[model samples]
Target: MHNTRSSRGIQDLVDLFDCFIVDQFGVLHDGMRPYPGAVDALVMLKRAGKTILVLSNSGRRSAPNEQRLLRLGFQIGSWDYFLSSGEVAWKRLDRLLRERGGAEPLKCLLLARGGDRSAVEGLPLEIVDSGADADIVLLSGSMGDRFDMDHYRRLLEPAAARNVTCICTNPDKIMLTEVGPRFGAGRIAEVYAEMGAPVMRIGKPFPEIYQIAVEMLGHPPAIRTACVGDSIEHDIAGGRRAGLPTVLVGTGILDTLSRAEKAELFRRHGAAPDYFLPAFTW
Candidate 1:
């Protein structure tokens, strides 16, 4: 059903790719801390004359994200452009709300910490009580840390009953954090979906975000681009959807998938990436 090809390594895809769409979590660093050699891979790629376009689903604001990277001993450089799903959600919401010409502001039930709410700045959203439910559900990160699962499970019910539009700002299932691996927004979204609620994704695996990222390059299409990330479902799938070659970083899910499973996933969605690496290059 899909045109999939199995390549041996990164070198296989390097030839045709100029820009890279990199996932932040499992590929770059975890939520709590930065992973080893991740920055080096970025620097190496930049030095090689390829345009580096960082794409991430991190729900935290750019300020906090940079600070987190710095404190975690990762070299974030002086300035780098990262397009987060939060930013995407805000823009889409803003545009949609404006186009509707409805003075009634959009209500948001943020599924993340208040700190992460910085991404929603300037948006006309009423961040009300999670239990009360809102017109739309904006899931940035996870409420698992600050709130209880039972609470989340409870929150899902009212939102579903009201037929609130569910929007997952990030499509990440798990992140490698300083405190070890942890669940992401996609995990919560899945839980909501199980209750027969609607969920829309704004980040990876969706065409919208990457479409904007590529345009930021200011270069014509087919400029030799590559997508590198840890998750096959999101990052790899996004690259496939974008029609760019991709690199599967294995440090996160490699041990979990057998050779057959990985092969099948790669081939199931269009041609498999031109290359596969154990993790981000170093």
Candidate 2:
């Protein structure tokens, strides 16, 4: 029997867990600004001596993401730590570069937001334009705010033909930005994967990123930690798979769904969260 509860906000978990792995975009902010009561929730949790790791599927590394959070008026320094998929991707890529014994710098076809190349900073990855000149394809994000799946498949066809491995930093199919939902790196990665290109996807719904989050929680037992996020496919499913309890923030991508609709959504995904929060506030 697991401790599954329905609650209004994070206040319900004050004494249930020592650590909280919070999602960024929908739970904390909507990409433009922090959610109401979100900062206060962090403050309340900190005052209660709970450890908070602001986990995100951001394509940018922790540093830039930290800076962005700070700019968004979050008390980032008070956080126990902030971890992003890009940070994990960099570590794994570093190891791959070392173990592969490549004589020259690894030429990479980088498809990312313009001026958002922090993930490969100080690494051996050399960004190239054409996939034909690459050892691997690095997808941090989509080139534009919106993209077509067919366009991506066609663009990646050359690389797939060459058997180039694609490393996707953020495995989110869509992002709930202030302007509304838009295609994310995960959607593009799907196109590549569908085209017979080997893809390594990091972020939510993947176990490695969860493992990193657990390790960051000081190797605490999975039962003692709760993953709070919005997406059922990414957060709830991933947390359950990683053996940690999940609390779905109802205000993210599923904000429009009614209770019954949300239940159906969970059922369709084949997983249900241990808890439900209308918002992430305390």
Candidate 3:
């Protein structure tokens, strides 16, 4: 990719793309609330005829965290559509049951935000509701982005011995949090794997959620549509796989990529986010 224009703010990048597919957790809200410029930037995008959707790992089995955003003062009611990792988890579970019959509803331990299951509210499954006596653990955001590695290890030891598989709801290892970058389910899932427990990850930058997000759009989005996010692994990789232009947010999980990391990504997947912004402005 050749140099187009260089900018650090969201407003500066708006003219670069017509549609914005933003990552929810890190790019907008951290945990306590929405960042200062998130709302205004998104509003600008909308007013400028940009169609935006929050693409999130939370969509695996449910809608994105609208209530969370509302609590952060983002007025999410106006931005009605979002794809979450929760929805992806639900679909993955659905496929597993169908492909492998007699696989009873998952005796699952959900590892996500408090309101993550909006899409899986009545779905048939024996969800253990994290910290419960679950046969398997569904991992993701830590109860609204508050998680500790020590706590996760304590929870997993016994389950590993019992032959429980940990289902990773979000594959991104770290995310931008109010306190700074912190671990995500992808990191926890890795620990589970090292312990010899089976693991499965659903949602982006995994492929499952991407397909669903595109479907929700009713048709393939226009070429001008942009997959905006912070991580090259989930957001950028998934967007490229879906054949969409990607917008890399400088303020998200992977903001401080090492030289080697950046080089590896380009050498392997050729990621060159069409636009880069420090925050979602414009």
Candidate 4:
């Protein structure tokens, strides 16, 4: 059994680490606004001279995510760096395209929140109207708030049948919505994979993003850095894999689970956090 200690907030463990890699959604905010005390918690960290990296599984690039946080009342000096899965994936895609000598622009079908095209905004790829015409499907965000599983099935079936590759930048299985948590873009990518389409997921529970985040933080020792988030599968698992300490916040995904259920969840995932916070507070 894992010895996961329960704590009231980040205040109990501030000095243990010099850097914090924090998850944006669920832990810090719920898409629409910052969670109670979240902004203050960040301020506390900043005041303590902690290097904060606001990491996210968001499919939109870093600039938009940073802007959203600012609009939501988070001060600019609270975090040191901000990185998103979409930004990493975009960089990789750009590198690959350059490596290919700019032969031809690949036709891409982008699925994002509210028809947002920021994922492909500055890329050389052509945005195709239909999956049938796409050379690749960019699963950036979920329209789960607007559409259902069947909607995605019909949209991706044609591309899956043709064996078009899917690049899923955000691998979050569920997303926080105004109503509650709903299926995320990763779930849509899973559906495409179930349809026999090739999917390359880039985000939490994956090592690449962590590596980039660490580098952005000037390569702090793993022991001196902690990963904070609400999802065990993504945040906790990814942190463990990246050789950093993990802190699970009860304010987000696991907020509704009973104590016994949470124990079972840790057992099922076979990875547990080192500490648990009631919320993202100072």
Candidate 5:
């Protein structure tokens, strides 16, 4: 039973951990741009001799994310590494490729940003236009900003009927962007599951991505690692499930909620963070 308490900034809790698992979207940026002081926070952690991992649920692979962050004025080299759910998914896809040896590349139906194929750029996977030609369905993101579940149902139901296994790089149901909260790949995957297809989630709230981050931190004990993120269901709950200390940043998905409302939200979800802050900063 963890009681949610507020801290002035990330600096207040700096002494408690040697490694930081930082979420990108809410804590560092809001999709459209980086939050004020977020970049400085990274530099502060680096100066404090702490290992920082930008653990993000972004559907794009780390390379592209790094490039995007650099464009947004974040010092890319300040952190030890940037890890995204797409990279984790690519690993699994790579494994399947190794098992197939000399066979044809696995055909994949990709649902992602039109120009963003970084996740599968060098993989032994072939992007196909239709579900009928696909061996697996890869959902990197929503097709558009609408988040029309009914529209997705029409698209994914056919693939589900074909029993296509779907791998969702980002398991966030809603992306909290500056424009507004929009549907993510997770929601599309949900509809596929309802229509009877196996959905493999590769992001937060799941253990794989956290395991990778932990491994990169030289297998440190859980006590020395703290995960700071904005989403309770995805970040806090996921970190707690992975046995890492969790910190909830109120400036993201929970920005509009009051203290009491936040408490109720955590209770409703049956997950709580060790610490809470109004915003993530040094």
Candidate 6:
């Protein structure tokens, strides 16, 4: 059993934590805009000298995510650092290619929103039009707006047939879109995995991304750090794995869930947050 406490806002738990590893899409903003009082909550944290790190499962690089936040009215000094799964994966891929010492560039079948190639922009990779000719499948983003799951399945069937490995930077199963929630890249990666292709997920609920985020915060004590997000599978589980307390915010994914439904979800995911907030207010 988990001892989950209800928090009115960030203020209730301000003195309990020195650092905060916050999720972007759900906790801070939806896909299109910042949640009500989200920006002010961040500003309050900064004013209280709390270390704030916006950690996101976005498949886009850090710069693009940062630009989006800025456009959404997030000030530059609201957080101490920002890290994205795509940025981390890109750095690792770049390092591996450098160590290979002049090998042929790998052919990549890239999937992203609006044909965005920022995830692999500077990597030594050749973007192939067909999965049959690619060495690896890079599942960076989802185009659920234009393509449906059937289309994604058709696109990955050829690659799955060849047993090509897929690297999924964003492991979010559901994405909060302007219209509503949609299946995310992680769900697409699951489809490929179901078709017998190997999928390597690199994001929340995984250790590497959390380890990297903690390091970025100067290795603060785990007890003094808390992970805030709206998902149990990603945020709560990931925070537990990283040895930090977790806070569940109701501004995003948990907004529509009833109290009973939320409890069922906690049982289903086998993870519960240490604290729950009605919203991201300070």
Task: Give the candidate number with the greatest lDDT.
Answer: 4
TM-score of 2: 0.94
Across 84-131, the per-residue lDDT of candidate 2 in tens digits comes to 999999988888788878578988888887668788888887888887
Per-model TM values vs. the true structure? 0.83, 0.94, 0.79, 0.98, 0.94, 0.98
Off by over 4 Å in 6: none
Q: What's the lDDT for all of these models?
A: 0.70, 0.85, 0.69, 0.91, 0.85, 0.91
TM-score of 5: 0.94
Segments of candidate 5 deviating more than 4 angstroms: 144-147
- For each candidate, C-alpha RMSD in Å? 3.5, 2.1, 3.9, 1.1, 1.7, 1.2
lDDT of 3 by residue, 14-38 (tens): 6766666788866876666666688
Clashes of 4: 0
Q: By how many angstroms RMSD does model 1 differ from the true structure? A: 3.5
Q: How high is the lDDT of residue 229 in model 1?
A: 79
Q: Give lDDT tens digits, candidate 4, residues 1-282.
A: 259988888988888999999999989899899999999999998999899999999999999999999999999889989999999999999888878795889999899898777788878898987989999999999978778899999999999999999999999999989989889998999999999989999999899999999999999888999999999889998999999999999978787988888888788777799999999998
Q: In model 3, where do residues sit more than 4 Å from their true spots?
A: 1-5, 8-16, 59-64, 76-80, 91-106, 113-120, 127-133, 143-148, 254-270
Candidate 2 residue 74 C-alpha distance from true site, Å = 0.5
Per-residue lDDT tens digits for candidate 6, residues 1-282, read 258999889999999999999999988988788888999999999999999999999899999999999999998889989999999999988898899888899999999877778899888899998988989999999877667899999888999999999999999988887678888999999999999989999999999999999999999999999999999889999899889999999878788988888888899888889999988899
State the displacement of the C-alpha of residue 47, model 5, in Å, after optimal TM-score superposition.
1.2
Clashes of 1: 17
Model 1, span 1-282: residue lDDT tens: 124444544444556676767776666666555566676767666666667767888665556666766786766552246777777777777788778785777677887754566656777777876635488888888755555566778877888877677888877887554454566788888888888889898888889888888888764465477778777788888887887777776667553777788777766754365566665655
lDDT of 2 at 81: 90
